[model samples]
Target: MLSTSTVVITSFRNVLALSVLIRVGLILYSEWHDARSLVKYTDVDYRVFTDAAQFLLHPGPGSGNRAQGPLGEGYGDPYTRETYRYTPLLALVVSPNDWLHRSFGKYLFAGCDILNGILIYNILLPQQTRSKATLYTALHLLNPMVFSISTRGSSEAVLSSFVLLTLYAALRDRWTWAAVMLGVCVHWKIYPAIYGFACIAALAGGGRQIRMMTLLKARRILWFGVLSVSTFALLTGGCYLVWGDPFVYESYLYHLHRLDHRHNFSPYFYLTYLTYPSPTVGNFTASTSDASISISWLNDILESPLTSFVPQMTLAIGSGLVFGYHLPKTHLPFTWFIQTTLFVVFNKVCTSQYFLWYLLFLPLILPRVTMSTTKAVLCISVWVGVQALWLSEAYRLEFLGVNVFYRLWIRGLVYVVGNCWVLVQLMQGYDYSYVTRKYVESK
Candidate 1:
């Protein structure tokens, strides 16, 4: 007799098989290069590997002088020193691991995957009814992206998993506990904090104001704000107090000005339209030896809104309009999802890592929140495919030529359309919803 779990486990195996194939190619290529030929560890794992290096674990003239990374030192020393930039509070929760990094660093990094996977699976399980939770957890466990995060020990996984818990708590009407999770998750990654607005939207739904006089007159928002601020203050202050600034702790902060980066497939890709002729790759590469070529889209994404911030004001107004209209209708937890995707798509820099930021949310979107589970999976899988294709060497051929990367362009268009499909699914009113509907109907 086949149990329901068996069937879902089988499906998970299928996804796992596909994931193995997708990665086997990369592994084979790496193996194809021997010790003499291999350059250095690149790909998403490099960042996580390096992020760990940046912490107290690294012992070279720094915290413990242990020398960071399993094989090397610092995020960018042999590579480049890009700081791990999150608000101060984030460094606190994982401080235990930070301390444990010296002896257990390798294992600590390994355990990050274990911890996150366990949390995501169990947290989402009860939310899904009628045998869906098992399937959901199995799929998550098998997702190549999840495997990738675990392998590198990406801290984004830590933050994203926390966000899921926060959302789950809110859905359960455990609002205070939800606040605790939100405050903490935001402390780690500012991106998920956008969900707070979603929570507010949830509160403000359907022809009614969400004004609980206690929430306002009692200064509930103010108190929460203070609590959040204090928690961050303590964590960041304490960590830096011990480990102190490692090195080159600025790249993450510098991103606001790093418009010219070729990574991140944002709308900035269009900048090539106006600037390619001036310093074409042929000439640019001739003059500069290493890493000379860059997509022209950088200037446009970074250039607009330079004058007195009118552009930002307009953007805020437009965003306000979207929220104001949608707040009364669409579920709010997803509102930030729409905002993040739109900005990433239309803006200038859409890095591969950025995809994980949203991928973490799909489980919430699936089986009930918006699209059918199959469609939700498909929507996510398409973007993942686009990324996988882009990461292959074949992309570097045509991509490195025109600066436009024709294949990537075509893929981008597909992504835009797919993105719109989900946005509409989430933005429009209807119920394939589980938690969101419960949140509204309860009030």
Candidate 2:
């Protein structure tokens, strides 16, 4: 008879094959069904990426550009108005799209999605049963949202893969590799930098056993910090050399001071709407003559986009410090999830895609939690219900041309409150001791 291990291996191969087949089908459907029809399923961001790639391939002077994209420097074709708001490297990575099929980028991201599934399985295999590992891999691989985003040419899957790779490296005690990966991830998307403190603490031996000054002096910690910063600086500095100041402003600075007054899932939306010009209500500037003298000072404060970053960064950094110092290595994934949840919830701009940041770490921590199924369902319901509520109001505002900024902002508050409640429930049932014991048992 064949060995049980052989059977499990075969089953895993089968699962991976099935995932590839499913992704291929999704890619084909996205190209023909979505691309041809008026009802679009693919994200519009793909065009922006390709346009940037084309521009990079064929350099041109800045002239006759009208639609100043997020980059604010219209370097691409004058006719195309799409903006590319990422690093020059990302555009170069997808530059093949200009020559190859338009769906080339989608294929690339799909491959990353598959790689993420493999990484998920490997990360879990040592801690859980083979079947459990396979299940988690399948859950991530076959997830509709995950595949949908990847097939739509979003770089989120690629971003997520780098994050998982960092976690995988950290779990293996390859601190240097973890640091490098984390740095690359942050360069890819700025939010991953928040995990730096947790990573540093992990490298320096977390908990009260080590003094603060001693932790700072540890060689491994120093190397991790140095390599991470060096990697980020090298990549970003190199890009800046090529793309210059506009690249810096568009990619990094814009997001830092970004305040979209449009209808979105942010509690600060109404505040931004009141302070900035509203396209929804033509010729309406709430901060102008319409505003009373009593609240003019408040509007001035809100007018500065940096004002929102103060509270957001303070909360995010505080969470990182607490989790890094208090949590064990086994709890790092959960730590990241909570930190990301807080970051996204407290952000000046929250969107559906932002959910992927925390969702990437959710499966890693779920198997360790001692939560009951019913309670988990309740938490999920609350989370999704709040999103649905916000989306309904947002749809009315964006599509139906209704001015429901106040209602949408209120929904945003409810979403934030609901997410906090879910986090508390998850924390209560997390079984931190269980994870620590598992780590000890494994050792």
Candidate 3:
């Protein structure tokens, strides 16, 4: 009979091999599909990423002429589906794709997916049994959504690596490394920075009674905050110096004020679509009674992307205040998971890829959640059911060329409400008292 250690080792090895096999198989399939068809199966974002990489590898005065960004600026061309919207540094990271295979970026992201799985396992190992740790890691590694996105050449897997690394470092009390990793995450995608407050709260010894002045004065908090801010500044500032205003606008500001009306998953999608200015019609809405019915005032009030920021900020800050402050380092993932979910739910522009922002932390959260098997399965089904409902409408709109805007909008509302209820259930099942007891024991 195999010893416990041997069993543990065998389990780890099996999961690791399974992870590699799954990712490689999907990566090859994606590459093959893309090569065989004019209508590629890989994300259009992959094309943009490769174009940006090619531009980086061969920098020339004419580089700007190759593609135009969403704003008609260079380095990304929406017409060709090459709209590079991420930081230029990401382009530089994948620049090797110029000489390497076009699938190189996919491989890179897949590798990060593997690394993220390892990180998640290590982060949980100290608090969980070896068997449970391995299972949780397998949950992340074998997650179909994660591997599919990475194999399609999306960078969310890479972003998740940094996110998990930051989480791991914070749990280990390596504030400097955590800060630096978080800075990289923010550089890769701006949304990850929303968890900064949670990290600070964790560092200052999370608890509701912890005074604001105490957090402000905590040396670790100060160091982590300063380093994260400085690292982000240096990276963005250096990129700005090299790439100029277009980089700044596309990578950062564009997302801040993004009002994308197409292929969105947010509840606000229809509103954005209706309010968005059209080149031919402009912002005017013609009423049946009047030829010139300017609803510009109403549009301005309801349509401003900044209006979404109010709720998003409220959720972000509120999550930190409520969960982050109360949870110890052991439970930080719960704080992050809730914060990201709320942010994406309320954001003016959301996409399917945005789901990964919170999904990466779900494994860490599950170990402490007290849901029954039936309840857990029910929650998962409801969450996935709403997504399927939205996707059915989306398929009609995108593929069938049918106008399902109202149906899609109604589905979006269902999606958001379903997700919120799921979150509530998850929170209710979480062992908050366990976290409190752990903290008290440590004290």
Candidate 3 error regions (>4 Å) = 1-10, 62-82, 208-217, 279-294, 435-443
Task: Please provide, for model 3 over 305-386, each residue's C-alpha lDDT reduced to its tens digit, 9 standing for 90 to 100.
Answer: 6678888888986787677666766788889999989998888878888898888888898888997889989999999999
Candidates in order, TM-scores: namely 0.64, 0.88, 0.88
lDDT of 2 by residue, 171-274 (tens): 77677888999889988889899899887766555554655656444877789889999999988886665566667777788787677766467778777777
Q: Model 3 — which ten-residue stretch has the worst lDDT?
A: 279-288
TM-score (C-alpha, index-matched) for candidate 2: 0.88
- Model 2: lDDT equals 0.77
Q: Write the per-residue lDDT of candidate 1 for residues 355-422, one digit (tens) a residue.
A: 66656555544544545678757766765665565555235644555443445555555666666675
Candidate 1: stretches off by over 4 Å: 3-110, 121-127, 172-177, 202-218, 236-252, 272-333, 369-394, 397-414, 426-443
* TM-score, cand. 1: 0.64
- Error in Å for residue 327 of model 2: 1.9
